[model samples]
Target: MTAGILAIDFGGTRTRVGWYSNVLELITREESLSHTEEPINAVIDRIIQLAQKVVPDCEVPSAIGICAPGPQAYTGYIRYAHTLPTWDNIPLAQRISAAFSNAPTFMENDANLAALAEYQFGAAQGADPALYLTVSTGIGGGAIIGGQLFTGWRGLAIEPGHIKFPAKDGKIYSLEALASGTGIGRLAWEKLAASNTPSSLRQIDTVDGKAVGEAAMQGDALALEVITEAGRWLGLGLVAMVHLFNPQVIVIGGSVVNLGELIFAPARQTLAELLIDPLFNHENLLKVAALGDDVCLTGAAIHAQKMLAS
Candidate 1:
């Protein structure tokens, strides 16, 4: 019999389930809408039903692992998830374990799982002490030290997006509030509306990061200005993290990374400018994540394997 572990990647928009053996092979793939408005138990039941359909022949998985949006307990319970409603203080691990009965279940924040995936198989492979940053709808961060997920006391370490950035107005704002995708969109909308910047983006009415990228690529000066501002903020946030951890590698991921050099070039330049030590200025220390979408499932399998070993 082929031994395998079941993995679930639960996001705000969709839920994905798959199985993995030694290599992170996809046995089956199933997705369901993440109904954030519904109660936590209702969402759990939907996920369980979907998992049952995919692995009907398997009696029990070696273990079950979940990657969820968090404020979750380091040990297992979910304290709160911003994307999902009313999930505060829910015993998520216990509920999932009850569903399996025989199999052990484990859960971690999605960003942490992404970091684990990078450490085990992706950009951070062979790099001890690495950091992963996902800059998308919202910014999320995770870190691994000596090949172990560095979840600090109560598992809430490496939340880099929450770090404050000094503003020109003499007040400070969080990286998420200034540089996240949503923040970029809001900034573009406000700036374009307030000024007579002659650009295609202004005609569209609805502004988003994708639109901002497209405009920048098309040589819209205002778009380039806005994106550079976001990149600068992101770099400033990473500077704090780099000083604190001094990780060997930093992996940048998520939808916003699609901006590619438009974002990364400015971010790298700004980071180098802010670093105080000449020792920290180096190439190959930072790179984009290579695993893409399968990262969470891969990390979940790794988490399950660790649980089995423990």
Candidate 2:
């Protein structure tokens, strides 16, 4: 019965749809496995159906905001997403908007939306130039500048995860390959196979970045070592980001963020060890997301609001 927003945060493995008031308060939401393996049309159908359940009785939402993976909404075309190979040619914003009485639609990469959410309502909280990193299965990030989301060059800028690194295993690696959650789990297994070191990770049934953090919390030497190594790489990536953007505030979020200071401490050390000059002046320049798991969803609403105001 209310005219609000239908916000969608679409990821590789999950798709979240939320109902929010025009003022940006979440009223309800639904989550589902993305099932990208299915036909592309079916995936879109499911999202539309979920919207029906959450936004009850509204003939049309005031607006719609969609945060999808990979390329931005430039021309409403998704250029690439390894997880969504079939989505490249579709004008997603137009399609979704058409579904809701052609409600005004805004779309962007999930990381960009997350940064906007933080800048407007969460940790960044009005910092002039802010940056956000979501270091989960992979590292994804975006930036905010002059109190607005800085989605440069067709909304393709600020992909901090892909920062370059020296060649490894006959191919050059990016920051995500070395410092993200997936990278942490991969490193743990590589270490387990290569070293005779004793650690609690050997006892876990499934070892992921989360398990590594739990093990490290329990004082496991190898687990702690693996975290430190990942943190150092993460720090190296941060150093690169700092130099590139000189952001006033940097907010780190996502599953890997739960690794907490065990990772950040070393990242900070690396920042101190490298970096020709100091840049941070804001208090807690690097910190966890205040909004937690729902950052992207909140961001979707923020995007919707921004689009409405414009």
Candidate 3:
């Protein structure tokens, strides 16, 4: 009945709260769509409300952890959230800590925490240098080096998605702008409008990544092309990441993972064809993340446990 960890995965699209026993087993969880228009205090209120369900008023968690989007500050400050503009300079971790009794709270970039989760209990468990990329509304990533979470000098070392590249279109775009789910959706729109491709994607009213992915699943030619192009960009980005971090393994997760092989096949093929380092060119070198939607929450718990131990 005692609570060991209370964790929150505060993403741009969804927010989740998890309760875990001392053994790190997920006891229960609650989630809801995230509406960033609400102020930070409102988000806190909702988290406390959700937390009280699994955790009674009388019980206190040993530690608390939160995983958020965008570049994270190690000093417990919210630098900025591309999706949640109201989060700039917010003391998120401190506010969460203040809500509980005698519990220490920790917060970090969701992508970074996800990497930690994979290193501790998921696909990258044994790798000394591993990488995690979460492709959702935007792309974000984290690195695990020498069996430890590699937060750079300011704890903002990894910003893979933000890395910009000059494209054939004579425009520069961040990897996220060209390859994430939002990016894929935008690309689909461009293809549909710029070319008269006879495809099912044109039938969808709002062709987002999910819609395009569904169309691809049904074997739509244009959808396939769109997904393939996104995958290629993703692979090129991965190649850059590999060269920079020299990660022994790369674990990718998030909503885009739902696209299955439709997306990964092309990325893998691209890596095979273009990656400079053949040692990491193998299929096994890159893995699908194991935790699914709970990846960040689990990572948050791990962060809390580490902080409590420290």
The best candidate by lDDT is 3
lDDT (tens digit, per residue) of candidate 3 on 1-310: 6567898888777889988888898988999877667777887787667766776457788888888876764567777778777777888778777778747888888899999999999999888789999898888889988777898887888888988888878999999988899999999999898998899876658899889888889999998998999998998898888878777789998889888888888888888888776876665877899988899999999988888888
Residues 135-187, candidate 1: write the lDDT tens digits.
99889999989779998887788888789867776877889978888878877
Return model 1's CA RMSD, one decimal. 1.7
Better of 2 and 3 by TM-score: 3
At residue 8, candidate 3 shows an lDDT of: 89
Error of 2 at 305 (Å): 2.1
Model 2: lowest-lDDT 10 consecutive positions: 276-285
TM-score of each predicted structure versus truth:
0.94, 0.92, 0.94
lDDT per residue (tens digit) for residues 1-310 in model 2: 4588899987878889999987787889899988888887888888888778897774688888898887655456666864577777778788788888898888878888899888888899867689999898888888988777888866689887888887446767888878887888888998999999998788878888788888888889899998999999998899888888888888999888877889999998988888778645334779788987678888988888887889
Clash pairs (backbone) in predicted model 2: none
Candidate 2 global TM-score: 0.92
**Candidate order by lDDT, highest to lowest?**
3, 2, 1
lDDT of 1: 0.82
**TM-score comparison, 1 vs 2, better candidate:** 1
